[model samples]
Target: MSRENSLVSAQWVEEHLDDQNVVLIEVDEDTSSYDKGHIRGAIKLDWTTDLQDQVRRDFLNKEQFEALLSSHGVGNDHTVVLYGGNNNWFAAYAYWYFKLYGHQDVKLLDGGRKKWELDSRELTDEVPDRAATTYVAQEQDRSIRAFRDEVVAAIGSHNLVDVRSPDEYAGRLLAPAHLPQEQSQRAGHVPTSVNVPWSKNANDDGTFKSDEELQKLYAEVGFDESKDTIALCRIGERSSLTWFVLQELLGKKNVKNYDGSWTEYGSLVGVPIALGDEPGQADGKSA
Candidate 1:
């Protein structure tokens, strides 16, 4: 990764295509997407399989996550660049997941494969190879995330950011990832949490906007670039994107992700849920 919080341009990624320590991933929620085509030298990680711990539905544990990275030649010193076949959604989430496991030298492929392929970038249909290796887990950063208990305590705090869609925020459309009964406990958002949906930071094709635009976008939602913020979504993927925008794009050093997400929180019945107020107040829910 670069020395500062900013995206690596498409041109930059292309220039380092052959660098050994650089690992590229083409994420597909479905395997068919990767089978069709992907960037040359890009390995595929089926998000539903490789990137997550299935039973947990959260990011993999440090040991498993580190092993997966090591197998792909990723180390604390290696530069891991991730992209996606389905827009940049899963790609950015992968970036956020690795970061949560405390990997610092990682980056997102700006514009993802969509923009790269549109620009006539080279691609490959060959099977990927890997050299199995052991990777050490760096100390995890917990501040960038929050569990239900911590979030409920933030009733008067203004640092939590809910990166779910407006409809989800309003309790109009709950994420199907969770069972319907689990959705009933909390109908809105954590008290005081801002509705800065992850999708708003990117364009239609899943590429992020210019930094100037990002500054204003986040500022309008009351998330200054320098403030300490915790991002969460229905699961963790959406908030991971928010973590990327805030920490990597806008250069916010204090941003973190709530990896437990709704999958974990929604199951915690009566653990303090708010409807209208922000995260800490527990006065309201997402709606």
Candidate 2:
């Protein structure tokens, strides 16, 4: 199966379980989910620990990333499949990080854990023991990623998307009560960002909406493939899902995910932040 596509169905994953070159990883916001049950032979990666830099509020450096892959027995030629809780929120973020670090073959398990459970597929608490492998790390690709400085510079030049809740975007809430990590010193979106909650791209079953439905949803907010786009949420994970939808699923050419997102932008000093609405807002609003 070609890994060029960003998603694979549960049945597809099941068929590939015995493939020697396939590696399945379950990444979740809540790491405890792995203890209860998971896909057989699936290794667990905690979003907060395995994917983040402990010293800084950033992603793992090349060496650190290599260590993660090596410890998990993931090789450069292996196809990495990721799925998790919360509608694949962290799974998509993992996908974004792998792409940013130049992993050539990465895919998301469509519908994530919800679909797998719903299908009554195999689940196990047994952790697989595999020997570590030496995995090569590629040069970081910044094109698909956004830093704070890049975001500030792109404020007026590019299409900025705030893929967060209306209340958070309107400066009414710092973060959802369940996501304390997203809490920032300030609230509100970057100036000129359009609000488009990430949930709009998915269906009730945790699957993605159809192409026509997706196009219409994005078009309602002036989104098109002609312009460059940067999507952001409180901590950047949710925005990664939106980035995947627009860049890969919708086939947009130059969409980037702002991994620092509002947590970095809203907390930073000496940067202009807009609350409620901006001039000529995509959708008029008062807060």
Candidate 3:
């Protein structure tokens, strides 16, 4: 997917608010943010509950996803526009899910809620009521997803991007500073993975950086765009943004999001784990 098709500006969203072919949805890190106020006519999807499987660590299956979207009045042909707080981290996560389920037309609201609020755009608590439709979701697409084994196999062969903070990359912190330091049993990152924090992809206003800027940012980190890439964070939300940057915006074909990420990898039995800031040796020792 290209930037023109995968991203929409807030102004574009505002103009399309009344378009029957468009569906505006909000998915936020703070689940309560949508209840307070959102773009008029926008619907809320609780990332923690709606998208996740309550019984397992994975996402909702095809039938479940279909039911959920159908209940929300999303038709198969509608264009989905997702936006949210925290620089659209969770929204990007939702975007990944939509792609995984083979949604033909989906896009992110550039800059998301943070930029909208910064520009003093109008927000409302009122929710729109629409009739439900039959929404059929395709089978999961494995192309954009990376499993734990693929992450381990890509140690030195492919580009494994550790999209966590510097401290987290060095094993000084388990999760983002704002989040509780918990989840994985181990602390360090995957062996031979480059440290490129996901926040670098965005501007201070929460909008994504230009393609040229993003290309330079990744290039400076020794990123080889030609090789297969797996992007990961503690639980994969942050890395989804990076995955979007590499695959959708930058137009790379071999990029995947390792959704299990550090939480699953770090807890595994006897996998190589690297510590310190540098991309350590494949043997798992600090460089």
Task: Tell me the TM-score of each prediction against the true structure.
Answer: 0.83, 0.92, 0.98
lDDT of 2: 0.84
Q: Best candidate, lDDT-wise?
A: 3
Name the top TM-score candidate.
3
List, in order, the clash count of every candidate structure.
Answer: 28, 0, 0
Q: Residue by residue across 1-287, what tens digits does model 2's lDDT show?
A: 22247788998899998887889999888889988999988999998889888888788899999999999899999999999988899999999899988898899998999889988888999999868999888878888988888888876667888888888888887885575544537877787688888889888778888778887988988775567899999888899999988887888778899888887888888787777744233222332
Q: What would the C-alpha RMSD of candidate 1 be, to one decimal place?
A: 3.6
* Candidate achieving higher lDDT, 1 or 2: 2
Q: Model 3, residue 69: displacement in angstroms?
A: 0.3
Q: Which pairs clash in model 3?
A: none
Error of 1 at 126 (Å): 0.9
Off by over 4 Å in 3: 182-184
Q: What is the lDDT of candidate 1?
A: 0.71
| Lowest summed lDDT window (length 10), candidate 3 | 175-184
Q: List the RMSD of every prediction in angstroms.
A: 3.6, 2.8, 1.0
